[model samples]
Target: MRRYETIFIASPTLTDEQAEELVKHFEGIIAEQNGELLKTEKWGRKKLAYEVQKFSEGYYTLFDMNAGPTLIAELERRFRNHDSVIKYMSVRMDEQTKAAERQKVRYEREGRRKAQAGIKERSLEEVMG
Candidate 1:
């Protein structure tokens, strides 16, 4: 029951409803396969680094779940054979997920430091005197 994250791009030409349906279809597959879907996110339309099937932008969706290897195989197979899918990537998270979580927290703290760097901090003497 390792955690897995999958991100897939759907064609930009699809209507909003169509895109939702596609996401739901994959979710259904996971449920049917007894995979626990932890999170699903639709990133909306975004520009691609390169053209995919003559489209410059596509809708992105992410799925985070815990499941066996079989579910991943089926998901990839569907993406490969489906016309709507422009690109997809899946990664099995081992202990690497914890490292990523720690990195994310550090990144946020660094961002806050950068944003507030211009502000002066109060010294102990300034507070007491």
Candidate 2:
């Protein structure tokens, strides 16, 4: 299994429910192929850097998963055949990117810990003063 990230733009005309359903549909595809989905993020409707299918905005969704190459090919094929999907891109995650992501997550956790500790120390100083 290899880590992959997929970002797809859905038609902006879709309601939130419709967009959620579309996401579920694609996720179902991945699950059926025995893919492990690590994350799914909805970016909401946003202005496109460029127009696609005559639309100036789109609902963006990102998926991170571990799956085989064949699964990715099928997913892309389905997206191509779907009218609601304006554009999509999938990229395999290299080792360096994965390492960077891990490091970033660790740094975020450490930052939060330090912030909480600072708050506690400030409270202590206030009590002493």
lDDT of 2 by residue, 1-129 (tens): 999999999999999999999999999999999999999999999999988989999999999999999999999999999999999999998676888999999988987998988844356768898
Pairs in clash, predicted candidate 1: none
Question: Which stretches in model 2 have alpha-carbon errors above 4 Å?
Answer: 95-129
lDDT of each: 0.94, 0.95
lDDT of 2 at 10: 98
**lDDT score, candidate 1:** 0.94
* Per-candidate TM-score against the hidden true structure: 0.74, 0.74
lDDT over C-alpha atoms for residue 47 of model 2: 98
Candidate 1 regions exceeding 4 Å error are: 98-129
